[model samples]
Target: MSNVQDAIVNAKDKLPNVTPTPPGFHPEASVHELKSRLLWGEPGLSIIDVRDHDAYNQCRIRGAMNMPMDRLPGGAEFSLQKDRDIYVYGANSGDTSQAVQMLREAGFRRVAELKGGLEAWREIDGPLEGVDSMDDPGPDAYNVFARLQAFNEEKAKEKRMK
Candidate 1:
């Protein structure tokens, strides 16, 4: 039929199947919701860390950009489109809400605050960056590859005890 219709059919065939975001979602996103969107391969979204630089550097959601609350106006204007899907977080709920307000006032239409910050992200095992952000630190402080060996040792000790 129409070229636009044909293109839509073709594109739908090529794209991976993904669950769409539900309607009626609030202006705040839970860590689980953001994680689900990321897992579903959603694109054209930005995750912003509105905490201080040191806190961001110490640990933050993987791929999150550090745009401390004070700098949101200029930074968002320079780097983000007004209609971009932006999820921002800060030190706490109040800070996140404040950052969301700043972004909205600066003309960002699709901004949402991430509730519960990094601690909530940690609960869902969301990816993070930093030395302390490892999902599995194993039992050794100095050896990165020691987990398997430790597991084997534990198994052997169990066998001996049995």
Candidate 2:
């Protein structure tokens, strides 16, 4: 093989596994898996919290949209395409499983239960909303524009360093 071809092969081999993992349904997924997927920034996926309103308002996986169990089916049908990759959770594992089942039965094929829900996510230091009660706020914690700008700058710096 030419030098360029060999280098391309080597680089592809070293690429992060998560980047090559196509979005799809799994019966369950750990917080770390979901975190990697989010950091990889593939679009076409969503995190859903099926917990009640108050609980969802208190804490949840950042970027999660709430659709309490009672309203889940209708809500999902209204907003989501059947093939979109969806990660769902509730108050606990059991609830999470139930929510996943509900979504699957509703004709949504790519639905995975988020294992361990919010607590597991917290254990992994995953980004969260409604975390004001738990820790001191960072300067751009709730500032979307500021956070986006900082993220963009950091990514640019990393690219330059690379």
Candidate 3:
């Protein structure tokens, strides 16, 4: 029994239970607070929506820019100055965190994630434009919508040919 206990202690020591930082950007404020900050806070903060283009166009924070995660690293076309605060958010938690990390790696210093993503924004009654608030679709839904739209256009062309 002592030998087994010794082995267990050794194994435990070898396996350091390091808690990873909670995934996603940690917002300094709730959605309402964010809204107020954006609208009333000091100048220089930029809101960045890290979802796809369609999602961004469908409905997003009024002035937020669409900076998709997959296209990051080499695809970013903006000049984000090091001194400005950058707020990032997506449809959900995990993706937003991943986006924040990518931005940090790409050299963004002042970065934060909207707590709970857009869903939380809706919860806080944050205003949005374009699509309805009820139409908060996930990433996969956006992909499906894009494919369907393409297929519909192709079918229209075929009909015109006949």
Candidate 4:
């Protein structure tokens, strides 16, 4: 083999084998996995919400930074380390994967799509902010909505006691 060919082979070997994905991790990380990591106090990672500004501002996972999908490259480049662990989610898995693909193409080495997006996070009772308290009852109160309703009920009970 030519010297250049040998060098190329060496470089390829150094790159991670992304096809099979690393053991104990997936290209799309589950909400449970992320929750465990947060509980374990894992460091060297960042979560990105790729939804639009309005949605992100209205409600988002606590500690997640906004980096809208359309603005990913520019939004992330200045603030985020290319090699650090990045867990990203958008409106759904497809949007999340698209963002992840873009980040990888832009030379980010450790971007992972967050599976099930914000809904799953909320299901797991993950921390969140920017959501307004619901004033009226709505259909299908469960998970996050259930928690909010519970809070409101507790507050009402307290007021009655007072």
Per TM-score, the best of the predicted structures is: 2
As for candidate 3, its clashing pairs are 24-97
Q: Write the per-residue lDDT of candidate 4 for residues 14-77, one digit (tens) a residue.
A: 4554421112334667776565555444577899999998999888887899999879788888
Q: Name the top lDDT candidate.
A: 2
- Which digits, one per residue and each the tens of the lDDT, describe model 2 over residues 1-162? 346755765575356544243222345766655765665556779999999989888887788999999997999999999988899989988888888898989999778888788888888677888745365447765675664554444334433534
lDDT at residue 3 of model 1 (Cα atoms): 65
| Model 3 lDDT tens row, 22-117 | 111233334643554443323667788888999998888766878888777454436577545778888788888888788778877667777766
lDDT of 1 at 162: 42
- In model 2, residue pairs whose N, Cα or C atoms come closer than 3 Å (at least 3 residues apart or on different chains), thus clashing, are none
Candidate 2 lDDT score at position 95 = 88
Per-residue lDDT for 30-118 in model 1, tens only? Answer: 77656655644457789999999999988999889999988977999999999888999999989999889999998888788888889
Off by over 4 Å in 2: 1-25, 131-162
Query: CA lDDT of 150 in candidate 4?
Result: 47
TM per prediction: 0.68, 0.69, 0.59, 0.65
What order do you get sorting by lDDT, best first? 2, 1, 4, 3
C-alpha displacement of 79 in model 4, angstroms? 0.8
lDDT of 3 at 105: 82
Candidate lDDT scores, in order, read 0.72, 0.74, 0.61, 0.70
Clashes of 4: 0
lDDT of 2 at 159: 36
- What TM-score does structure 1 among the candidates reach? 0.68
